[model samples]
Target: VQILDETGKILVDSGVQKQYVDVTNTQGSWVVTTPLVANQKVQVRVKVSDGSLWSEWSEPGWMKYELPEKRASLVVGEKNSTYVKADGTLWMWGDNEFGQAGLGTTGGKSSMAMKIANLENVIGVAVGSNHTLALTQDGRVWSWGYGYYGQLGDKNRTYSTYPTPEKVPNLDSVVAVTAVGDYSMALKKDGTVWRWGGSSSGVEPQKLNFTGISAMAQGNPRNAGIVLKSDGIVLDFQGKQVPGLDGVVAISQGDGFSVALRKDGTVWTWGGNSYGQLGDGTTTNREKPGMVKGLDEVEAISVGEYHVIAMKKDGSVWVWGNNRDGQLGDGTKTNKLSPVQLAGIDAARIATGKSHSMVLKKDGTAWSWGKNESAQLGNGTTVNQLNPMEVQFSSK
Candidate 1:
């Protein structure tokens, strides 16, 4: 076994360290200890020798190592938090009144992060008001929590709670998913969209006519959905267009509005603005998408019931809109119609809930602020954190 940097420099040579000394069992796998000497892309190849015969070197597997700042995906529900680590482990915490936490029981609340029992290989996750949706690396979708209204997509008409993951029936090869309100949406690999649960329609998985869809976001009501197409067009699930938006790289939907990040590092927002979730420096609602005032180099965005959060390309975080519960993480509860930057931390990604905010730092740490009546902060207490509080995950 050998590990080499992108430039072909040897980083680790198992032959020199005799790491593969167990040569008696050819059927067993070999293990080696290697230290990464630099933060960069590396490739590894393995060779097996059985006494007299030496096997050819295996195909190289390339991987990137950005230690301490590895990537992570996070989602904050109305009263819970969910995160997926770089290693594909899924975790959840906070309110579980309806088994939304998916721990197999309807526990009141969990102040510490709990690993979803037996859930692995997760590539993405979305937490709705009272349910969750997870996408595995193999393109399967699993859901749990509130199954009422058929949001779980298992085809059971009865309304109830599930505390464990259930495979979404008749759905496969799903690339992305979002659980919002009493409904859920999935984007297939074929660029088509599917909808299920209670919305303007009934509880069932119905295929949308739109194709070339890349991503999806849920707007205020369960019926409202924003779709991002592969051709850079942004449209609503009802087939209405998001005016003034193009070259969009990402999209996020809130209570009644939606936000989109353009390829040129700017943000465009529209829909309801009663609490200024639009971030356009006004409380006026917009019928068409427009640029969010004074923000650029934006990388990602998340919207809550009436608030919004954005992560800039520089890793800095900014917030706007409703702050009655201090979800803004800006050390105050005053509402802002414009964006306000949070100091002292740079985040890799962010997620917004009904009245709380969650961020995954570049260094792989989780933090939260705002409504903590149910201890969503995962910091061992129910006290609300006006600013960021590091969330402690239970040891696996």
Candidate 2:
């Protein structure tokens, strides 16, 4: 097999200058380790031999380079779900009562994902109770939906709802955005924090005094903000360091609790554990961070109103906490005090809504389970799913 640049020059693997590399019949694919320039166009052609005469080169297949930020992503709100395809087109469905689906109407609910014609080049999306925020490749933010609490960040405090996307004023260079409850928060490229919405900040975004923040997560219902610093320390919304928590690489917040993933692959939890969402084997609220029971080598995590979903390095998913609606995807309504492995799928990404859960599988397909009263599962039905079911989109 050989890889050629746009000009037809053969690309050699690193540490060797050979124009092509031979592969065994057993090898189904190969990786081109040579560094590629941004936006570089390339093509590949393959040939096979049966230990005799060599076959002619196959047709060249074109490949287009895309930045890492251009990859697809999924996010869920209280009762709605949104997805941005790799091509930068956005799609959404479920509860549109408040127009959170960004479909320009609030009367009908969509069970299958519908494309949002107004949004393009969306790199990331964040959803709150009834509001949605989209971050574009240019580092600008767009908002819509319930605006009574000013969560829209569009500087229209009097407007109760925005059925269409509106550019959030005064925010630029935003690397990330998170929303929950009645407000929203943004992290800038400069490591600064900006907040708007709710009664605290009004309609315009206010720059918080906090700095050096590497990432941020906000708790649902509680609206508590947690930020991770480059120095590996975690701080709460008050800018106070979380007790006994350090070396944290990622953070997520739920109803009244917080979760942190350490660099060592262990999970930690603190705060309200009324339903054992903390995975500590006891419904005890932790004022300080403590290691979650029976979990390790965790690669990623997502927290819902009263549940937690974790993915291991091997792609296995585990969940614990309030499972009254089967959000845990364990095929039962039983709430687990400790992490329980979710069988049947290998997850590439996971998201949790108020009472539902979603998983983007390694094969690029999406699945969902749990409460579907509002059709948030995107399965074309309103039946509650106790196990994972493939989400059906209206169109590709």
Candidate 3:
């Protein structure tokens, strides 16, 4: 591999450079070095042996010389990054290749934090492929990520470089909000649910006309959901009761399915089951919620892109579904048709990134596993894994 200047000039030549591989196989450094020899303008070019002849020098990684500048927030496209500090301050990193970081136009990945101004009461933060959402205790939602799909919900197509709260014509009454990947969902005080986004999210779940709705799980496009009433009844958007289940206390988003945890500790699931992600011990797809059969005492649950996880009241973690990307944390790449106990993880809180999961312990510690292609695992670099590892949070 050789680092070259824009005019095809050599910057750094790894003499012979014959031992290198392509970008996909490289977890991180094989293409460009970190600290990047400081303030240098260069990109990556490679040569490889592919079964026969050495492949021609491949196209460059296209990276260029960039001077370091600080920012408060940034948003590019699919790649988004943000963080909440110990002092309640906010920071961002990633593709901001488009200024979606909310820190003005300082796009591109930043190793430092960009301060989102004038915003207070920061409680939680979420990112989409190119947009950002910040949650405040006052029940207000701020967005600055992608706006191209009307996803910003600000009803404007112009991109923003700072956190701005948008009121969905009828959503000023929203009580809580959630954004997954590039879609958004809101829960209302009237036991209703609301949402907006791309077709990928499917058709939006209808607005319910109920009084006791207590919880909601992701729904079709924009934001739809399976509403769990206070009386242990599940209903669709028009107030019609959903058949075949009850006792749901929590609901989570999964690849092509939804997992609901009943108050009694038993688990129920429905929707796309191509990978048997529902944990019913079979690969059959069920349009309505079905019981998980034997999982009891489940205290918490989370859904990965193609996998599901549950935490038992006894500190045990259960994993299921697509294991090809190791999102199951099952110590192997083989997918599971039903829930399997994830050995050795003593956890309290659980969170699922697109293809990875994080386990937060009672000791202020965290463990990560699955895809690390973007360093979402926080193990210090981009490397996918089949098992969990301690995440060293960078405070610097």
Give the winner by TM-score. 2
For residues 218-245, what per-residue lDDT tens digits would candidate 3 score against the true structure? 5333334566788888776555777777
TM-score, one value per model = 0.81, 0.82, 0.67
Residue 330's C-alpha lDDT in candidate 2? 82
lDDT of 3 at 277: 85
Worst 10 residues of 1 by lDDT: 26-35
- Among all windows of 10 consecutive residues in model 3, the one with the lowest summed lDDT is 69-78
Candidate 3 ranges with C-alpha deviation above 4 Å: 1-120, 124-127, 156-173, 199-211, 219-224
Answer with 1 or 3, whichever has the higher lDDT.
1
Query: Per-residue lDDT tens digits of candidate 1, residues 306-341?
Result: 999999989999899999999999998899899989
Q: Cα RMSD to native, each candidate?
A: 9.1, 12.6, 22.7
Model 2 C-alpha lDDT versus the unseen true structure: 0.84
In terms of TM-score, which candidate is stronger, 2 or 3? 2
**Against the correct fold, how does model 2 do in TM-score?**
0.82
Residue-by-residue lDDT tens digits, candidate 2, 186-242: 999999999887762477888887999999998764556789999999988788899
The Cα local distance difference test for each model comes to: 0.84, 0.84, 0.63
